[model samples]
Target: MTDPITIQWTPKTGLPRRLTFEPLEKGYRRIEREWNGSEWRHCGSEHTTDLTLHPPEDPPTLEELISQIHGTWDHPNPAVLTFTNEDTVAEINGQLRYRSPTQDGWYAVTKTDLESHLRTAGYPTIHRLSETPYNRADFTADSIPRQ
Candidate 1:
């Protein structure tokens, strides 16, 4: 069974949109939404499972980077925050994950909720990622402040 995929696109000059795909029997159903000044409105849906509709060409959203921080364990817990730009998607322990370093499962939340939580936690985040190509999961913890 394929997991539900959420691809976020924050363009350089416009509002961002996040498309989530729920896998079905043969294909998938997608909910396309765009921010319309106040909130996200349903742009449309599709019968096909073509992921190309929300390609990973865009940069990682702040939410995606925050999820990585959620999985980032400092010492005792396993270091789960690994980076990969495979297919242009900056994924960490797979995208759209809600589990923290010590959690069992997940607790899904809305984008607004996520933003609030991350802000409250105050985990130092890297504002920019290097465009330089690398072979492995080459992310560093430089954004984290020293104790």
Candidate 2:
């Protein structure tokens, strides 16, 4: 017997529908379900050996968040830049400190300032070492479980 394949389906309108193609003795059986607003309701189960299948791509391993690091002038309020996609995620957080209390907003932060901030934050400010994960999947599903 051929290994059965589960095909991902996209609806022509509205939300997508879930369907699978299971191999049968004579042909293939297409089992489909419908979304009734709240839960998935059974729609149809039929032999669909003639129909073509278009499977959707697998979901991404990680949700990548990206953030642009920028400096603050007044710095009474600071923001972090972050982005997340289905595939990957990245974040860039920053801190702004003046050389002296007298230093005005006119002074813009430089690489030197970023290093100092990292030092104060207990990171390797001089080497600018990064401990970002090599594999993001470990952070996504392998770590925690639902309570």
Give the TM-scores of the predictions, in the order they appear: 0.31, 0.27
Q: Write the per-residue lDDT of candidate 2 for residues 1-147, one digit (tens) a residue.
A: 577766555677866577777788878888887676797777789775544455566422221101222332124322221111111112223322222222222123434543454434322211110222122222223222212
Number of the predicted model whose lDDT against the real structure is largest: 1
Instruction: Please estimate how well model 2 matches the true structure, expressed as its whole-model Cα lDDT.
Output: 0.38
Candidate 1, clashing residue pairs? Answer: none
